[model samples]
Target: MGSTADNVTKGSCICGALRYEYTGDPAMTALCHCLSCRKIGAGSTTFTLAIPSPNFHFTSPSSSSSSSPGSTHKNFTVTHESGIRLKTHFCGECGTFVAKEGAGENEFPGLMIVNAGTVDGEGVFEKLAPPQAELWVKHRVGWEGERHGLMQCAGFPDGL
Candidate 1:
């Protein structure tokens, strides 16, 4: 699917303390139903858009510095069942997760998994990139059911 703004997509934290934008199309889009994602999202699933690292940029000024993208966000690193370490960036002010990046020898080394829900603009969530698959469906909630017709994987998608 294409982005809401031609080849650009914008997003921010719940409190608008952090803003970000990415150019070009997402590498992939999917719904993650893994237990860790569920707990981190505080929901049944999380819609994510994977964009190339070079294409993603933080537009908001850092809470502590004007030049760096490091300060003001909390980074939490979690080791997945596959032994892949993923670091998630959460807004320091609102505590809303914005994106995640894989660490050291991970499959998606140059891609950032952006939280689709954080995307800005009216109807952006509905109009932005559509999920191409559902991941970790084995951990999906019983009542949520499945998103029929989409590629569903019990664990990680094949071929990365």
Candidate 2:
């Protein structure tokens, strides 16, 4: 059994093409109602697990750097298929969406945001802390009711 405080957790995408070992505490986890999220997630809202950069880990060993003690693992790679440089990685054979990185690299400092749905098992969502806030609510399709007691926002927050 994995505890909520577990340092590591495994996740993959739909086709299992990608695999990831996420570490450290997630900065935030939220259900996004943006159009982009809905299109990618295929759901009314997209659940994301945001974490600091240092906590993000990739299982694939990159040719750029050899593995060593205390060194980071390169389990996945960011693809530029859509010309937007979406940092999505997955296993080659299974095509599973593992984890995403580099969301708040420049402004927020060390931060990597990932989708919570990528985590394996049914209880992963139960283990995660409730979302602190909602983003892109202006594009929300319909009322999703109350979640975690946090009111949904119409758009990006003033600061965030």
Candidate 3:
């Protein structure tokens, strides 16, 4: 398991079309039961690692701007699409969702927030703590209602 002190973790979608570079230390890493995340990830919960927006970068070698043979860092840019003011760059070929920007820009101020499950590594999940709180508890599945020790909230957290 990588420590919180580690810098520059890399990840990509299953098809390799979407790639990302995360530089900042993740702030909150948790499993979310919100309906939106569950539908998109196709899982019971969505694992997320919230990072600063400026710390995330795209790193597909084919997109490098310089035609020269030796430039190391590829030219990359954050993109916006799908009616979302926040920049959401995904794979052009495979349509794999990559990293997102502008989340909590005005509210939290400086954080990109990528899905930790998308991160590439072994035992990444082990390093994270079990979710401290559950949002949108009104929508939680019936079976989950009896789970022990889960903090439940009827809606998004007051400050969230």
Candidate 4:
């Protein structure tokens, strides 16, 4: 019942106004407890999938991002001290943080960090790799119960 364009899996914003496809499997996955992540999720943590940029694409052929009827994509870039930039693309309608791009070379170079919850189907994220690391445990807000044995770090792991 899925479209051909839904190759790997179809993903969109909460409003279904934005849609894209991420082919193949994700390269890296983790739970981030950084302040930035917490703010975007409005919670203590965020589950992210680092997908290869080449495999991620907007479903529409249009040049603009608002190909969907009711949704729009907005960009926000954060520059680090090293001049590396991080661009986050989110749903303009519902403000759902969809993906993060830019010069995050230490972790997933040339990969985009996407919010796992945005993927088409529910519980699909569970099918992916279990989180191998937990970032910013120092910033963690509360107990999240038990989880897989994750390599805990104060911030982004040097070799992540």
Identify the leading candidate in terms of TM-score. 1
Q: Write the per-residue lDDT of candidate 4 for residues 79-140, one digit (tens) a residue.
A: 64335577777777788788887655553477888888787775675566677788878777
Give each model's whole-structure lDDT. Answer: 0.80, 0.57, 0.56, 0.71
Can you tell me which runs of candidate 2 are displaced by over 4 Å? 1-6, 15-17, 61-86, 90-95, 102-109, 146-148, 158-160
Give model 2's TM-score versus the native structure: 0.67
Q: Is candidate 1 or candidate 4 better by lDDT?
A: 1
| Per-residue alpha-carbon lDDT of candidate 1 for residues 29-83, written as tens digits (9 for 90 to 100) | 8999987787778899999888999999877755244224445566788887777
TM-score head-to-head 2 vs 4, winner: 4
The TM-score ranking, best first, is 1, 4, 2, 3
lDDT digits (tens) for residues 24-94 of candidate 2: 66767777786655655567877777777676665544423423433232233333222223454444454
Q: What is residue 99's positional error in candidate 1, in angstroms?
A: 0.4
Question: In model 1, what lDDT does residue 24 have?
Answer: 85
Models, CA RMSD each: 3.0, 6.1, 6.4, 4.1
Candidate 3: the clashing residue pairs are 52-112, 53-112
Which candidate do you rate higher for lDDT, 2 or 3?
A: 2
Angstrom error of the Cα, residue 107, model 2: value is: 6.2
lDDT of 3 by residue, 1-160 (tens): 2333466678876676556676656765545566655655566666566676577666774435323444322222332222223444455555555555453345435666566666776786675444556656666677756345755666545433
The collision pairs in model 1 are none
Deviation in Å, model 2, residue 81 alpha carbon: 18
